[model samples]
Target: MNKATYQQQFTTEDSPGWLAIDDQLDQIYGDTEPRHYPPLCGLHYAAGGSDPIDGASIYDSNHQEFHRHIVSYGLSELYYDEEKAGGEFSKWGFELTFRLLPFQDDQHDPIWAIQIMNNLARYVFTSGKWFEENHFVPANGPIRLDTETEITGFVFALDPELGKIQTPHGEVSFLQMVGITNTEVEKLKQNPTTDAVKELIDHLKKDNPLLITDLNRK
Candidate 1:
């Protein structure tokens, strides 16, 4: 379903939440510690039986001794970038971080979901993003690693009324992502059922035929 076909969800229930996602991805995000980590989103991987095993259980299974999921990625010290803005999104940029669920549930891998989202972004926007992984500080714009005491991360919403993007790190506002302005957000909030939004719905619907941004998904 496209944006128009998608029902707006005000409740915190997971059903509608999943409906808004290109793929219902919030579950694999792993709800623990500091609230946010890396990859704001994850793929649903690792399964036992036909039933799904929880993420925490998988974390404990392998780390049995460390007793902490902090270093699961194997980085001694995590570096924080001082820049927070990018390309045209500088003034409105935000950072999202998350954790890996580390367990599998017979569904699909979070990496695969990442691949899907990347492809979806390309298919929908015709712009290549969601894959331009940046290392070190961004060449231009704001880049700042937010420091908080015992604070992991949070899913940010530029315009809460529009939609969201879940990352392994945190959630970002879907509308604000592609250079959204106050005027646009206000319009979206006031008239979600407008024709322009309907057009978005149409676009999403037409994207189901599988447009390949990368052919290496094996």
Candidate 2:
């Protein structure tokens, strides 16, 4: 939608951006109530009591085999503010997403995904740095601390299913975080270019089209 149109339409809505995001998800998820996880604590180093990422919603995936899809809130301007209306890009122009196979026992909730997103948001809120398409991050250790897993890092890609959407606040891309092995991290570091990341993602898509992060994949 055009800036003028969005501005006019969202003027009276309390949280137009938030609603827009929910509406987009509804298209994919229908009426399924996702497992939502709010910020664990009120205090954060950058935003203090207000976290940069307000919450995370995890949905049972339809496009992948027994995987969960996680989406974030607050990476963008989720609430309406007259000053931010119809901007070129929403706060950061994107929210983080992750698709993962069951990381633990089947009954175990995916709260870890929420924690990871908050940590990533904390990095951005504190460092003034932001991630973009094809960026990669090495997790120093297992992506899950104290876990015996080969998945030691991540690579960002536009979510295959959610892709991107235009909101009253601006454009928001669902940037997906895909787990990678330490070996893959080393390969990405060898070139450390968007192309390298893209190539790796492309190769991954051949078998895993949805790019679901499997902690068991070596």
Measured by lDDT, the strongest candidate is 2
Off by over 4 Å in 1: 1-111, 120-172, 175-218
Over 1-218, each residue of candidate 2 has an lDDT whose tens digit, in order, gives: 55576567766557877887899899898999998877767653346665668888899886858789999988988876767776788888989999999876446777777788888998997898899989999888888777788999999999998888888778999999999999999888888999999999999999999999998898
Write model 1 residue lDDT over 1-218, tens digit each, in one string. 22222223222233332232223223332343222123333332222221110111112212212211111110100112122211223211222222233322214333332332233333323432322211111112111122111211111122222234442222433321111223333444565444644443334226311111111111
TM-score of each: 0.21, 0.91
Q: How accurate locally, in lDDT, is each candidate?
A: 0.24, 0.85
Query: What does candidate 2 score on TM?
Result: 0.91
Choose the strongest candidate by TM-score.
2
Worst 10 residues of 1 by lDDT: 70-79
